[model samples]
Target: MPRDRRPVWAELLGTLDEKFVANAVVFEHATPCAGLLLRGEPLRTETGALDRELVLRALAHGLARAPELRRRLRPAPFGLTTPAWVPDDDIDLEAHVRFHVGVVATDGPELPVLLAGRLNPPLDPRRPLWNTVVAELDDGRVAIAWRIQHAVGDGLYGMRLLDALTEADDAGAAGDAGVAGGAGAAGDAAADGPGSRAAAPSTSGASTSGASTSGASTTGTSATGTSATGTSRSTPTVPPLEPGPHRPPRSGAELLRVAWLAWWRRQEGPRGAWHEYWRKPFLRRLRRWGGRLVRPVRNHVLVVRGLTESLVPQRRYAFATHDLPPVARRARELGGSVHDLTVALALVALDQVLPDPAGPRLGVPISRRAARGDRRNHVRMTVVGIPPGTTLAEAVPLVHAAVATAVEAIEPSPSRVAEPGEPSRPAATILTTAGLAHASPAPTIPALGPTKSATNSPTLSPGHSAPGSPAPGQPGSASPTRDAPPHPAAPHPAAPHPAPDAPTRRRGYASFVPWRPRARSLGPALVGSAVLWPVLDPRDDLAVFGSSYADTFSLAVVGSRHVDVDAVQRAFAELVLGTADDVVAAVALPAPPGAGPGVRHDPGDQPGRRPDRQPHHQGGGTP
Candidate 1:
């Protein structure tokens, strides 16, 4: 039915998290925008001014096919209902597609800063929740960067939108065909295709121009000799926008249905009341395997631990390389995928800087591709404890096993209905006596404090902590310096202590965190073997996000102005790449065809012919 009610999922997410943090600092500017970097020829007029007409035409054409792009969110009166998607009666393309005059160094270290600066700002709520920044790089290549709100779509949908925009000729053609149908279709076509004429800037009584610039906009008409009023002699023939009727409000029943559906999709539940009763039994088994699920913190790295409620504006640092072939080859040899290898590499790198190796509870984002709803955050998490100073060979297996177990556990199981006599829901606990009903709450159990790992103990030296043991002075520690001063370079603590009476120890599994707390701590950081994959046009690809995070890691690293970008990159490369090499070396190769007495030389081996076997993939198959 095209979901006429409203974006229930988006409303839920928006309300759940009002803030996002990273690297122990709150990310004040986390507005959840899916960004893209596209490389293509600069679309400029011969006059050297931005070809507003052509650009608008092509963009409009693309938007025509994607109705979601044309829709603007209208929140219900006083937040009484979910935000509904309505057609933007006033569509302004120029305001959305802006031209940047600065020289963009696409491959340099400055690229991350450029992207963060552009994305940190929130998308205009009144308009279509998207913007495109077209900047000309120093090398004369054009970089088209897009920032679309996550509330509107997800990674896959964002990719589809970009795919539509890039196919200029096809988009324009489709847009032209749509225009002839009706005013509504015409508006969609005008949003993306070059075949349609562009609406002049509302403020100016100027005519659109057919002439394209040789380069992007740096100087206005003052440099290009074009009229400031935009009155050009060659305006292309295209249909003008005809105002459409105001969209009718959704029915009360429809609105109620949406609200009900959102409630049904919630993670914690009435059925989950069983967890409250079954928690003790589950904990007993978890304790036997692994102790309390304490999240591992990177104590070695520097951090600015701001107050949990305070707003801490944070920035991101991104560096990518075109060299992944060697690492990929090595991963296959170690009986692991590239993802497994990446996790091992990250742990190895972190261990180098950490005083002790028993990693904090590291959360790996696992993608829930099979999720039913079309919500953006369709992902689960897997927490893995990286052992201290573990070799790449050993770590890969550990990573693989941990991820497999987490993914399997998170999978949705068939719902079990309670018997007629049993209380399946909390509401069912009511008992009627003497015409009065009394609610009987479930029996509350005494919560246990955090359990100290049995193997957790002290170490003789900072780097010499024994595997599976806790750091000095930590619970269950036997070190003499348990009361020694904290290390001067120790990383900032992540958060405040949990409530005194709360269960200090709990089993680790795929569990949902409260929206506010999770949002407050979510920010950008190097996580889960983050790999940089270059696109067909490396110059155009603004960012390359590793899909592994959707399914394995959400490592938010907080970086500051004082952070050394080059130095950090070098250390990271040394750890991840070095680990890859270690894995490849550890793999044993088949002893070279058993050097036998009967030496048989074929014609191919004798002269210019090819050898029987050339150096191909190692580890027996392609990574």
Candidate 2:
């Protein structure tokens, strides 16, 4: 393996981030993959079966747009250097594209079960690290599930790949289609649900489409990759790959030479060779060492708790979706970003199930790529610690500040140094946001005309805000007056409460693991923590993924067997749709008889109980 014989991107091998290489190595047993699951009108043939040819054609079109899909990893011998991306000359469409014929209802357990089964297996490492399964349901609808290895690309990249595959549309048409039923029927139905359908005041005219956007969230299960009408748009010309086999460095000496060349090339700019090669590393090391000496003891405890919980191998998953505009508006009114609100919601939910004295340490993945098309896994993990007993209102600002600090301190590459007396593991709970897939010109919330001082304003509930807060020069404010009518989407003071079915309507769909009397746990010290790996780190106790599609914000919760993922999902929904008080009361209710441990009782069925609570303990079995 010589440098001259390698591909054009060969020089990047040694300079690759350690996180990227770690992701490749971890693929041996665990599948660190992000996925998209979409339900829509079935694509059929003259004989009334799934149109396999059409599906394959569309996949080929998309693969051409995303060259990373056709690339496979070529590992270094004896771990001498990072893996190199090489072109796969032959791709087996039949092996990668699969079809399952069944009547799997969107709201039923069958869909999730089928998806889990597909995700349980690892992708064929010999070829590309991506696959698709098109399922035909009994109701004449089809569900498309697409997955790609996290090592290749991230959530944003997945959205770009999806955008390339689906039918093409101008920005306006895409927005309109997304608002209608283009994204998915489930998302559309949920978006129109009571108390959650109000349009946010926007300077822009685009309606929120249900179509998955480029900024939509990518979780183990994503709804952002819907192929509207299952039609393939015309394929664009893709540049051909270099015509030769990729050869990675073989010997230790070659690896060093490659590393040195990559480093030297990076220093050729104005930064100068001496400053970059010597001064910068020394300064960074000194700062890290100083920070470690002053790092709090509580941080150490949080890391330990996360490590202890990571030993459990068995995991469960849950999914839920909510309208994004209203939530986004509410978050804005509360003086925080949508991301801040989501982090607060997740922390509150985790606190309900696992109340730690030192608070929960959250691992937030920050992307470092300059463009979405970069196939390299350029990401850094930042850990944020939330203090115990913090309410939703209190946590928002704290989380915002902590996240700001962590983001500013992130290094371009993973650091080898560890703080004294701390286990180098990821936070116990990991929270990730893929961002809005298709962003509108106007902000999610309409601009407030004018308003009084912050101290003089009325205090709103945790998840609620006044329909239209007065802006700086508005008539209702203490400042200059201006006449302006209220936005049409604003809720009236006398508006009727949402019907009892509101809870069910707020969520597009949900799936939880049934409680088993004898749930097994992976013994201690079997896996590494995310601090040393990716978000799909083997040691994670719970990982919550958030993404947006059109007007909808989707959440996917992945947790260990001992954790009650169902409870977390329910808590999050209630917190978003109802008040904090309502969540507390609902979570306090007892479970109905015959409902297994960790199963959430339907609030509609149990008249007095809230919809988010779990049953009381009976035996020593895990929840």
Candidate 3:
């Protein structure tokens, strides 16, 4: 195989790195698939009906720009070598694209409910590992949910793909008009009679549209883009598929040669190949043993002690939005970045809602891509520890310094090959932040009109302070403002220790696990120091994903079934907006089953209550 024979873009798409391979392995063993969910205005025809044609056209344009979507993983024969990226000749647009009509009661839980349903199921490995669903809301809005396997790309890559699917600017107005007109023409043909319309495109054995088989009620037409009464309509012509370079299966001899070359490249250095090969293995063994020896004590002191774990296998999602300007200004006033503020606020809010003796350790992911266009998952994880009862102001500087040091200390290509049933480092929660506003242009859909804030939650505007909230530098502004009484600082009762005869839980090995058990007994016999031991717990209590696009900063919290995601979301919004009674009332809802009573603060509660003990800022370690 000649590397230079392929186009640079195609080569990038086909090149599988250790991190990418690990992601694939993790997906197979533990984690479900991950992707993006975006909401916007629904594209409508002149007659005000959902315009399916325009949606397909926009998707076609996106597919052309992101050729990675048309490729699938081809595993090596009998696990002889790593999987190779190969082109899928049968690119069925109808099978991959679907529509849902008027199923949402409101923008709040319905969309996430739909998203959760879509996310739970794994994408078919045989086909291109991506799917898009267009959802029409009762409020006349549209939510586009696109899910891709983790092996395809990371969060940043997903954002880039989203950019490709959308128009650059108002320039798309004419294109939207053209597509809508074509759809109207098709509708007119359908009106004449079913026989007058163009023939429906041929489909493979797979269902043409997911929504068609979902048994959900749809308005005006069926999910297949035909009338509910079964009249056929001419489907819009989508752009030709532009898949990556096709690589045929290699022979056994070829696989061996490729594997040999890969090993040789690994041995290339100042030292001779023989010395480097032996030395590397020896060092890895030494480190592994050293880690195992010290892991229990380290985890006990830094992770397990003073922490509360409320995680279960089930996940629930809650979203909140903040106006960017005020949050940015506040962060700058506190001598930190928006990311620092985000971490700080999360700590404050989590402590209030799920009060523990100690603040949770946060696992932050840092991207290590060499360039903007790098398609591989070049990323590393760094952990940061916040002291118990630290106020927002105190937490910000600590978080800032910790994140900076962690980023500086990250080694290149630190991702190790994932092994089955391997335990990951214990972190109570994970925080992921992406500045989409600073990335590529925001997705623009003329038919959806200007992109607006997806949430109806109240936001603080520029030069505006939260209600009854002082300026950042003023007194009473150091801690997050609260409208509900703070929950008692006492930690929730620790989970009951596993029964003596109960099987020890095996922590899942995956690139991502939403929630997991918190503590495991390593036994005093193994450490020869303490009776109680601490080991890596693969599950986390919570994961907060924050992204900024244009003027809005959105935070989505995914938590375990026992956790009250909605309460966390509300607390986050309150902290960000600094508003009081009305905001809380508007956002508050009954807590989900298994959740504790919602915590509300009194208006008289002080905002600058300092911690009684000295704050401890734990340095970053492997996540």
Candidate 4:
């Protein structure tokens, strides 16, 4: 099969990346990226310290089998086509890993600063777009950092790649050292096909074969003379390779096809009963959609009074774990799911921070992984009004209802559409549950050292600074003055007056008209990183990412200097605590017998779902 054809979805994502790049350059920030920080026990061996060369060799061997790691981007010439992925024949493994001495925690106080420094530089698209940094900490542990471009893979894929390099048992550890070189022989270079356990589009632009085992080596090595197999190798510097030739881009016709396919995919959906109302002519459909749109949340103003932007960017991370069983129980009692509760918690938290009671429309992502033949960037968001000034108990059901309505209207792909009367899965399920289809567990590499979860600080004090106060040129805490100009890109009111009430729903997404003033897409974007990739954009006023592991919940909040971190932290703490209080109140009443507190339930489980599960699709504007 020809490997030059690019998948429509991949090309669409690459085109979006180009837009994000342009936006970041104009806004003085880097394009959004995803990262992982791993820390583990010390790497030690019976003989002596394992050298960096062995570690490099093992990683190089593993990455060679993972085609995504060896695939550099080939841009389309003259903006005529979308970017394509091609094999990188000349890879320099040594350039990707940075060696550091001392104890570095993955979830440590110093992590944000360190991560920012690494992220400051834009990725060189000419080469494979990723890097792994290794650090040996004073605590006799090792820290590994993985950074990958969003276009290459999502969070689930990143976890799988990490798993391939790890070993869970001593026997597995013994096979790790030599595993790197021999791993490539296990490569399955064919495309990932529909229903394959491992999914990645082949260079031929088809989703066919499963992932190659070349990237899944058992042995890992570190500088402490320890390998995953307990062997040690002499230290030697790995030489860099000469750069490969640049490949020619696709034709303009292909670029046009890519854009057209993306648009068509955005409108795919089932022809179901709920959509019957949308089949009317243009005017009739418009009138019916207009009425339903008002039922959703209202869009609020972006600029708040008494707030200013800071020239520097800042981040504050906070971690806490709530009892999942109790929270899950409360959601069920309210006729909602755990996912609904998470969104409510976010909205309530925003209300506490924003000057206005009602918050801005949120960009809520809905994963489209069920789509056949689509192995890349299959996510669409539904914009909805935030329910501020409402209690968790009152808001839970409302947000749940609103989300269900929005998903039904916005999802165009048939794979994601629910059967008639079948309830849509809560977007929150991505964060609240474990055992998602994408995650795989593997053993630790001995050379890299045994891995462990980093200790999380119980609570982040308001206004408290990270261990390294200000990294190099970063600014210390300070309030911005009114004179500080607002972000040039974000929507600003002509004056600082109250924003008008939510406008009537327009027919053709009129608000996005290039001629009219538009709302800034640089405001806060919430991400639940428990399962999906966490998108961190430097230009946003605030980016909040949350993850729940074992019995702990962690939050990493990144903001520009213009925002108030102390105030936001206080509000966030209150919101989380408030939810816990609600859970405690509900613990007194046991759930109806036979209903497990955490059993997975969906619309199909409801008493009166239409017996025929399939729903019909309709043609109309989405809310």
Candidate 5:
């Protein structure tokens, strides 16, 4: 076989990182044939500042690097030096260019992180990176969705791509981390790729008309610790905090306390299991419960191969993007952009549920895509705290500053990622490395879409036997609609507001095993975590990025019937709506969120996500 002589970009795409755990699952169940091929979606912005033409040019550049793209698409693995997947570049274009872009319903259950835990997606080892659907909602919002092989990028990489293309002026380090930090001269030796904040051609240059560019938004730069994993939480109906303009700069000690407090609050309760530093026995119980109840929920047939029918089940998901322009505007009265103020509102929402303020730690991804080859799939997952002591008067900045610290801590390339670990088997891994993929069809708005059953016939099945007719994507199974492309242009709006200009929220949801097994039905937390990943190939880490006031905002999710969905949708929306002002302030003035050098300082630990099942790419957790 003649070795691929293509440029790094060209050869890169030739061999998808089959070693990733997520890749194996996708390969095993891919429609028996390859589906679509697209990179991630374009960054969403209310300002419509993205340089579409430049984006096209970037795509063209990617096409020119066909060999690399082909290499990226292959269902095989490399000898694991980061799987030999990343390509060198000067801009954060690789992540965007590697796959195609598409959208899903704005109103649906939040997407989960497939192959995140400790297993990898299964792959057929015969195709290319499957697909990425950039979903556009009628409510003026957008979602970048995909299912590339797990071997490609880690959670950090996924987060990096999402963070890079986001509107830096506002999304600054994806909420807290989105603060504009420093600048770097493009193509300069000291700032070439990975670690530098090199300048990209703006969406306004002569050759540019629509595509937008970015400057690193991490304000609170630090050699801080990176943590994107956290406990699952529900939407709380908190009353808005009294508006105010207050606070003086905190001493270093005070700053750390506030940041940790915020982080601890989210991680303290039952929802805080996600933050458990060491896997506890309770974690085992949760998995056992999931396996007993959720995994074998529906059995198709052994005709599918390796697993049984119940593993991957067909399901529906719904979420809401409640509109809050009124509340958002009102929030500005306190501080920050609509984004920052939104976080203040979310703090109110979450507070409504539990009063005790043992704030929890949460993970936020930092995009290293801006650094050339780093973009191939270089996601830098970072964690930040909501500060247990965060108060309304101090929240906007409190969270802003804390997240800022997290964003700055994520370097383009981990300082010393141990020689990439040996690839693991698929299936058995946990959620750590897994990414959740979803499909939001026709209705487009947060209303009812088509309800067709997914199928995985014996011919398509590798060997496992499923019960009834094999449906597309059963739990522990896979269902891919590669042939169907999301509406090329946002679909006809289901609501009177037909235009995709308004950030619409998707409202579809599906249920998974419950966090609390005793409940008759599962809630959004588990459903959002489990259901969303099976539909699309396991490569994408599509989370919910929505507004709080959108019509469907986590409202109606109370009764048993709606529990599985309504809640998760709202939580995803809250995540989107939450924002911080001090985060921006910190970035503008160079205040890293917390303490430390930001690198994976746990010298004895491995910083990458571990997926279960499959190879190099995988998800984690006992299940």
Candidate 6:
């Protein structure tokens, strides 16, 4: 019996978030996109508009379009939806977008407030996968935020939906619309702070379909030409992309097409694509599992974001390129490896922030083989150990300690006896995330990557307080390098007394793997952690509250609910940069690893790197 209506699950799947699933989807290149909201109108009046009608009407208009907010979803085999992403019960326009106008008992200018609260609530299997939030910023702007699990569809697929709903008339204007929803502008109510992509130049096209940002973690680097022993490895051939009926290729389709052609590619070597596809057949027995919930249209919320999302404008963000050539040159000067410097930097960052910081006071992801037999692009996670905080004087030795711990963590190979013939992920990953190392330590980070440890990850995002995401060097996340730990220029030169953990140690950022390949071709996405606690330390008072964002640099501020962003940024500079006034580092790392001795970090880089004859990542794992 063919049914005309979609099953309940199918409709629910339509509301699934694309960003969530793309987290797990590995990429050879291409960064993911994230949603950014813009305020259509600013509430300049202080007392707020007393007329409930217009405010309510606008709210109603936004909510009415909830179920209509749609995205094509990809279901897993056996009628199972990807574990990531969920839909909410229904949309509440007032809740999602608010007019802060409270009943002042006096009618002044119409100052309707936008609700900053959103629906990123945790969901269970019994319900759909999604959330809606009506976030009211301190300013009159409002933003609806959501975080979908990363187990659904690719970002491009999400864009297809936007194409369907968006207007082609002005499809290429990267300019802001006008006052509110206009291009490149976000008012206080617009949340995501200022200068967000939401505030970027407006999308050239009308992004009618809800926008999705994926591949939100990690930075882009030259992966093609690396100097391996002073000789470059030939760049491998990338497969071409085949255009689908639903979504056509952009004129710059060369790259994405390359990625696609690589996928489902024919097996040329000894191993062939399995003789047959494995299909789970539970539906034959109870076929109506999801079908029983079939309905004409499933009720869900629609999400939309501006192309030029703002960054809350506190501080510029960072990619691994931060130090670039300068740092690389400096590392060589110190007679150490580049990755060694990275380990040192991670430690320095931790030491600067953690209160009463003691022992390594850090976490890292170990790459282990996958549990499943598949070995395409996958990795399991494991935790690495860190000693307590060391004085800035003792930086090098401590960095070395952190490196040794990382080296030790990647040692054990996968156990074959009990787990034989199962799946095979990455070796460094499994051992780290299984919680074995986390539970065994004096001072250690919790498991995070793939499974999320504390708030932090390998690729760190700006967190006013506890900042951790699937960033590199986060616990159980991804470790960007495999190398010996090189010591920093220890101010003390001698080892410091062994220290113990402090109350703040309990609040350390959890670990995660932040290795992600971002393609400038696709723009940026969300991928980090943050935690804001109620308790303010005495240090918080001495702490400064100024600007962390300089002329060109910026970082992301995410996850934390209670972080006083300005204060946090100030603390970062005072503690990390040595002084709040020093917007740029007094001593900057070399720009682009291996650049000329005097070259500063090049802000305006071309689309690709120079076609050097060397290959930098011969044995290097995916970033």
Strongest candidate by TM-score:
3
Runs of candidate 3 exceeding 4 Å displacement:
1-42, 115-121, 173-312, 370-375, 411-538, 580-623
Q: What TM-score does candidate 3 reach?
A: 0.55
Cα lDDT computed for each candidate against the true fold: 0.32, 0.38, 0.38, 0.33, 0.24, 0.24
Error of 2 at 140 (Å): 4.0
Each model's TM-score, in the order given?
0.47, 0.52, 0.55, 0.50, 0.31, 0.34
Q: On lDDT, who's better, 1 or 5?
A: 1
Better of 1 and 4 by lDDT: 4
lDDT of 1 by residue, 92-189 (tens): 66556555544554334333433332322224557877865554443323434455654554333343444334332223344344433433343321
Error of 1 at 248 (Å): 6.0
Candidate 6 residue runs with Cα over 4 Å from true position: 1-126, 134-144, 149-360, 365-456, 459-507, 510-568, 575-623
Poorest stretch of ten by lDDT in candidate 5: 517-526
Candidate 2 structure quality by residue, lDDT tens digits, 289-316: 3433433343345335653223324445
Clashes of each: 43, 19, 9, 47, 231, 177
* Residue ranges of candidate 2 with Cα displaced over 4 Å: 1-25, 28-39, 76-80, 113-120, 167-312, 369-375, 409-535, 579-623
Candidate 5 per-residue C-alpha lDDT over 264-315 given as tens digits, one digit per residue, 9 for 90 to 100: 6647676564656355476754553343343222222332453422243322
The number of clashing residue pairs in model 4 is 47
